[model samples]
Target chain A: MNPLPALAAAASEKATQSGPTLAVSDLRISAKRDRKSVELLRGVSFHVASGETLALVGESGCGKSITSLAVMGLLAPGLSMSGEVALTDAGGRIDLVALSAAERRKLCGRRLGMIFQEPMTSLNPMQRVGDQIAETLTTHGICSRQEAARRAVAMLDRMGIADPGRRALALPHELSGGMRQRVMIAMAMIGEPDLLIADEPTTALDVTVQAQILELIRDLSRERGMATLFISHDLAVVADIADRVAVMYAGEIVETGPIDQVLDAPLHPYTIGLIASRPALSTERRARLSAIFGAVPEPGRRPQGCAFHPRCSLAKPGLCDVGDVPLKRFDGRDVRCLRVGERVQA
Target chain B: MSIANVTSTSDRAPEKVPDARWLGLLKGLWRHRLGRAGCIVLAVLVLVAAGADWLAPHDPTEIYYDYILVAPDSRFWFGTDELGRDIFSRVLFGARVSLQVVAAAVALSLVIGAAVGLISGYAGAWIDNGLMRVMDGLMAFPALVLALAIVAVLGPDLLNAMIAIAVVNTPGFARLVRGETLVVRELDYVQAARAMGASPLRIVARHVWPSVSGNVLVYGSLKASAALITESALSFLGLGVQPPTPSWGYMLATGMQYTQAWWMSIFPGLAIFLTVLGLNLIGDAARDVIDPRTQR
Candidate 1:
């Protein structure tokens, strides 16, 4: 028997459906190894409203991907999460963290969908691309197999893939990297979810394909009025796609604001460093790109107080290293730094 | 308009076309010299076995007193045995028997082993440990001895012999599938499938199964050759196929006593050798064809 409709209905009945499509509040994930506890994500909070795009930007190992996985309820075993991950939609409000794995799964690919970073390896090599997309529909008991097949082809066409019917018969390996990512997009969007979490969806593609993919994602999200939680390490890519951007460093978000504000007038020291390191078309020839001094600290070995203090060019020894730097709200942004007003260039 | 075009394009001919990938595999197999030879030899053997009823000159069990112990000649072909039965006819029938046992034993082991391995690997942690330990226990005994013990318990018969060989070979397939499944279950596609709300069962069937099927098919072909040897050993020991059924193993066993005749042992041994060679060659060729790195 089909269980999704009833299950989703039951979940949506618990709370009012008025807030953001996804609201992750104070979500923390930690694990214990050899009697030592390592907190992977320390009290992270964010929200993505309908038709809005929120980019989670960070360097590698800064808990950006882990945050996305946490929201999907797909964290690796041994990592435990706490706090509210409320998902509100037409169905109703449901705390994803509160639901059992089985219940969370029922909501996935139905109310929420996700695309991954590596388009090359993200699709099943053995399955036809069309069948793979159709499977998402069938898994949620959304339609019959034949209908799913027809819709799959239609979705492929909508993704700007040429000859949708013929391409549908092609296996993942037979498709190009751009085509495969498009297939992934088709698969994710076919469910017409309220929220779509894309984890570095264009990191593996060339510049041309990356632009195309970003445009496709932007257009589709806008058309569907879908909330998008886009994760990426490239400030340039995030600039073109994200409405708002959250910068994470060593498991904590140091700055978050509307994209234009954060890009034009960044507040946090880490965010400033990221923007300085970025290469722009207008940069003078052979001018050296600025870089943040230190790598993102490992989760287990993160520095006490402010995690970014070690790498911050604006760091003051006594003030930055000895106290917790809370995420403070100003006029248009939240900056997690003790010296938010300082004009020191990274 | 595009949606209608797509719907109509699919509706025009909804039937599935033959997969080009399979056609390419066959072409690749034909290009490999040893693979081609193996295919030809197995095809001939299968034809010989299938047409045994019309092809055999005389009843395999018929006793001709005048022709008893005759050497190779025009009338009796590979000549007559001590019991005056045609050796050629018996060998042909033995081919049929050996192929049947190999098919049954391999299929049975593959089903059980693949299922066990998939479940054990996909449901990791304690279940993986427990199931693998059991498989290790089964593999501890020498294969032939294990088959012998199984035959002893189940009683001496063709079906029991197949069962014995299957049980003896189950651990090999289980280990291979478990190893492949372990790698496959961690791939990005599998993780993507999970994010798409695919359950454990669906993920295993759709993602893990296809990824590992090539390895399983190659392994199964290799196992068939081993199963052939085991089936012969069981029948040679008089625990399989029974007398008067004209099994190659039994013929070889009985023929060993007639050292002077020589043809008795020579012909049956040739059949086993050729069949095993064909299966091994096919297995090697299949491995080359199915592996992407090996493809041109």
Candidate 2:
């Protein structure tokens, strides 16, 4: 058995015996527009064993961010959702998708926390950064204003924010992009939630800041023993952070397995294409950077059968065009491809 | 992790505090010549209106038959009206009436309209459509004409006039607030608040309302000026503040009957014109100062 899968299986077994921190199964989301409904997420499923980081990696419009939003119950109006987003917190297992908006709100910030993409825009401009953090604490009834403010400052200090007391009073605009993102992290982690969803958290920051924020997330997740759902478009970034990686294409997860296996021996063509497209400094100078041909298919115009058939290099002309391939497990990895089980020598 | 970390950490000790932009904005208004002048004029008018009872040398309604139509003098400053009432004293008192009506009407309109607009704009869907359609229907009627119609129905009285002016101004304030609410509702902070598990009401109160207040406040000031003019117009038409009471518009109306008597018309007309002009200037300045987009 491969070491990565063995590690993942061991982790899963450990979590199964101890209980999962969060489990989302068969989560589907559809959006309606102009009297027509479009499926945004089609039976997407994943779970985060306690203290494990699960990365949902895909190009933009592949529903990676949508999955995080769905998990958080932050989907916008006109979108219909189904399936279970279950959390096994101290309160016991509860289906988040079935909860009322108020009940969902109660869970949010208390049990399930989120750090958004753009820290600059995600924070209220008129409010002081400290007050914003305090608001989260007070909203969840975790503490009084005075206690929340005190905790907020301490949290900011812990997040490596300089002069936490004074910086607390500063507006989001006053802080640097990195500092603002740090404040966002501080706010999200203030409650020490069981599940923390970081939706493209480092996408807007500089490379140095991105590394810092990623390290911060990693360190904090480990310290709190929280299950992290880290969503990102950069496969390289996810490779370092995720224990398991779920590669999505056309709103469906095309492959999901241990990060090392998915990166080293990707079974799905989409995953292979994504992996190969990463520019490598170690490769030959004459080797052109591989790129997936064509943009992501528009939601309503997604192709039938295998969604990646149009762009798949290994596609069989007749078979790939004819039948939809359901995700099937092979060697402990789930791949949605017809040739995964077949021994076709490349 | 080294001495570089220690010095780097020390370098972070007291980052310069960014200047408060809103406070800077207020300072800009204070420095602006036109805005300052406007503010001074408004302050003087407000003081005069507030202290009218103590400032007026004579009871505005108390008449002196022998001194009727007397020209400007040390005793009867702006002169006397046809009824031998001190026009200066009456004009001072008229400032009180006009100012009171404007303040009351604007306050009432802002409270009612802002609540309605916030509900309509934020709630959206059928609630937005229904409330906005009603506002549109109300706005279709000319502001002054609507006030006149309402006053006529309610029977001409000071309270009726104030209520009429407030009712007429309500839709304008509602529309202004609703437009602002719609714009503010889409702001990222509002969306963030919503995503952070804030209820719709909490989002509106904490995130939406604060941002929209500056716009609403500036517009509300302008609306007060409009209400003032409308109240004056109603009084000028003999449909507002009865004859015995001191009203700038009433004074102007009665004063104009005697075309030969210039002081009769000039003093009250000038008072009304200056007050309205001062309010408009202040309102214009406020709009520029509160909205950064308008700043040069």
Candidate 3:
């Protein structure tokens, strides 16, 4: 190993756990597409408290994106959703799902901010960068227009955009990809939103910009005391920024624990396979990276028992593939496997 | 990393030339020969229409009974109509009427059509269907027949002619805008605006409107060209402007009686042709530049 992963794993483990969790429980979403009502998420649950980063990692189509959207109340119309996404406020913890969209959107205004995968298109191309930031501020009634413009420049200045005053006047199409991503981050975090959901925020940037942006997010989380649900497919990224990590497969969280515990001593076979699949340092020249056997199944056709059993190495003939496998305790964390102990011991 | 950590050479590049916006639009037009020619022709027509009062040698409606059926000469240029009105002066003033009819009808239709389109597109399945069906009913009629019916009910007057053409043009705008709105409303920036506590009105005004502007400009010019031709037809049918007004269509009607003079009908007819041709060229050029999918 090159030692970065080991170093990152240790740092994430050392990060402390804090107050009340952003507490998601029993979330379900189904949508009617192609004349079929597919259950996209099945009783998915996890939490991230203020001052904590929970990395929700999984492959494409594994319900990680759906879960974050549900938390933010941004699921597309015609989808059926049922779940409790509770966040603590001065009024006390309230379930976001129980509220109307307009009502939930009110909470989203001052409290929630989300950054998505493509920053290039997230800001309107016709709008000036300063005005775009000022719009969010003015729309929320946070400040006067003049003040918003001034603050926008200051915010851009802080975001490391040189000569923020001039840059603010330029249209979004005038900016580069990484510069636009920085603009997006400034817009999302400008009001110091309480719950920051970053769904693969750095996935589109170059490697160096990715590192810088990730560092910026981590720094923001630390300074703002905001609860963050960092969703990603990149394990190395999760190892660096996440305090806790949850591995999702087939609409359910199959494994979760402290980053060091989950990544170093993973109890679930899928998690083991995922970490093993990384192209890491090895003396064996041109060695092939390990990969999980099969792709994640489409929503409606998910197999019985453990969702990963078909691709899992430690799957037993009857116990692992016969029925639903509920999450159970192992190694001071949760793992959804009946043969986790048997497989690990062997 | 703060200011000094920013190395311009290593950062992402923005592929653009920093041209002033209005200048950029003009430059783009200049690059296309068809667009430039269309703009020049249209500009000359507008200038003539605006300056007709000062430029014309004779009053468009001034009667010269002695010059009735007279041929083109130094005394009565473009000859004289059977009513003894100067055909050249009438043709010059007719530019004003053509521009007014097209401009008013296009403006009215764009506002009404865009509003209907945006609301219908945003209203979802059943509501959208209901609004679109009503528009479809309007569209089902042969355009000229429907315009004639509207003009007949409103009476054969100038304002009524503009209104009739506007009503005829509304359905086209509504359909274009609605189709565009359906795609634009789903853009990420629009959704992001919604996430920021922006009401439906704000999102539509800020995000949706701007994206569809290029479509609106191209289609508006196209509809304006059609409306000018429709106005001439309505006037020719004696259902537009009125008899005394020096409209090109009315001029054409008078010109028919003095076909021997030829200049009476020919000049006005030529004026109408060139005006419509200019508008059409402008529309084609705008569509080519604005609608990316149609570009070569």
Candidate 4:
């Protein structure tokens, strides 16, 4: 069964028909200069069923952040985007790509919330932590200042921040790195958005704080029934929280499947390489960890045929160098490789 | 729900423990000797400017012919200028003009420069390139020469001189603010604000602006001293406050005609020098205090 069609049909057939909370199809994004344009996201497509979590995993410059920014309509001015981001809910299915900036802003922070990567620099240094969170609540017309403050305090408490009442008045600088991350989570969840985009949410945090933040995100997401697009470079983190995972390389998705399947048996060579590269506990202390040779292909100068051919250890002598391999279904998973047809088992 | 309730109870125990950093910053500022001195000086200057009339011993412009160019005496510690005007009275009144022009000019430049800089730095691409190019063109001209040209165009007066000085100073501030804004805009907080769905205006106002304001203020204070010097230059050239007004610059200009009357020019020039020197010292101290990277 094709997951796309099944999900789409399921989304349409529901009596409530609140539509797919966030959907992007064949989305393409590029950054342009005077005479050159570098494609950052090429034909990437995904959807988040209402209250489900979808993770986009990739290394730096793999277009994860760009994809999230595209969803938020917050791409920098030099970059041009062409795609469809459709959002449907109690209001109706509206194409987000075509909306005016003002209209998009109205939907943002209210219907769609985002948790950024770094907590240290993500907050206003001069403003109190409570005011920053309150600003979100008030901007979207969700609650009054008094109500927002009360809610902010509660949200902070829920995130395991100590002394929510007192800490609410503190500036961002006054808080520890972990506390700041909690404040960020609280601010994002205050509006109770239908969809939440957490881009590298735990990347900048300590291991303990990272675990706490991830747990808080999971618990809160479950409670609110919020559809989330979790973007991260760490495969381990994604495996823990993501319902489904999309592995990206350069600017395209190489493989996607349920988290367990993707983690246990990856189809794409890049995914296999990634899993092999990690330092597993079963490996001996003196063993040299496996690493994928060669960097990800540059955006503008990507090699002909397969973009990963230059780095794939299992690349067929002639087949990998000749033509582009479109994403195809294999063992109920999406894999883009000429070798997918071969009889190989993990 | 019961688990959450239990967690809340556990969380409440930590509420009594206070964060030491918040209290430390306040105490640190209070104990900083230079910062305290700078604050006191700024406050006194503000108060003196506010009550110039009550502070002056005599009419600033009244010509005392009987005591023409008198040396420092019991009645007139600062002596008299070439016009026989009490130099002490004129200097006190001159504080009102000097401080007012500096304050007003600095404010105007800050508003104009900050807006331009924030937009240029935050919104990169052709917009940033274009704004920077324009700023470069303005900066290419010498500061004093640009001010002189502006004064020449608008015609000479103290207010016009201030306006000219402000225009000349604007590019420096714009460049400074733009550079800082670029760095601050890339900060995680700015990215967080954007993710939170803050409009460009709101992000700049809340996230970007506050981070850069401290730096801008230090630059503005330094520029105010430059503006004071510029105003004096224009006045000495007969392009600022006219005669019978008793401006420090005017007194210096009048003293030039009297080769033997050294007291006339010396006192006023010294006042101008000391004021600028004090402002520069304070600006340096402010830079050290506000910028964490510079603080030891």
List the TM values for chain B, per candidate.
0.91, 0.90, 0.90, 0.85
Model 4 spans > 4 angstroms off? A1-18, B1-57, B123-138
Selected candidate, larger DockQ, 1 vs 2: 2
Q: For model 1, how does the per-residue alpha-carbon lDDT over B1-296 read when each residue is reduced to its tens digit?
A: 22112223223322211234466556667877888998898999999999999999999989999988899899889988989999999999989999999999999999999999999989989998998999899999999999999999999999999999999889898999999999998899999998989999999998898778778988998999999999999999999889899888888898999999999888999999999999999888878887746644
Q: Report the candidate with higher TM-score, 1 versus 2.
A: 2
Ranking by lDDT: 1, 2, 3, 4
What does candidate 3's lDDT look like per residue over A30-128, in tens digits?
Answer: 999899999999888777767778899999999999898888787888899987888875557777889886787677657888887888888987788
Docking quality of model 4: it rates as acceptable
lDDT of each: 0.86, 0.83, 0.82, 0.79
On residues B247-277, what C-alpha lDDT tens digit does candidate 3 reach at each position?
Answer: 9988887678756777878898898888877
Mind listing the fnat for each candidate? Answer: 0.48, 0.36, 0.33, 0.46
- Better model by TM-score: candidate 2 vs candidate 4: 2
Using Cα atoms with residue i matched to residue i, what is each candidate's TM-score against the true structure? 0.91, 0.92, 0.92, 0.89
Best by lDDT: 1
Top model by DockQ, which number?
A: 2
Each model's DockQ score: 0.35, 0.38, 0.35, 0.36
Pairs of colliding residues, candidate 2: none
TM-score of chain B of 1: 0.91
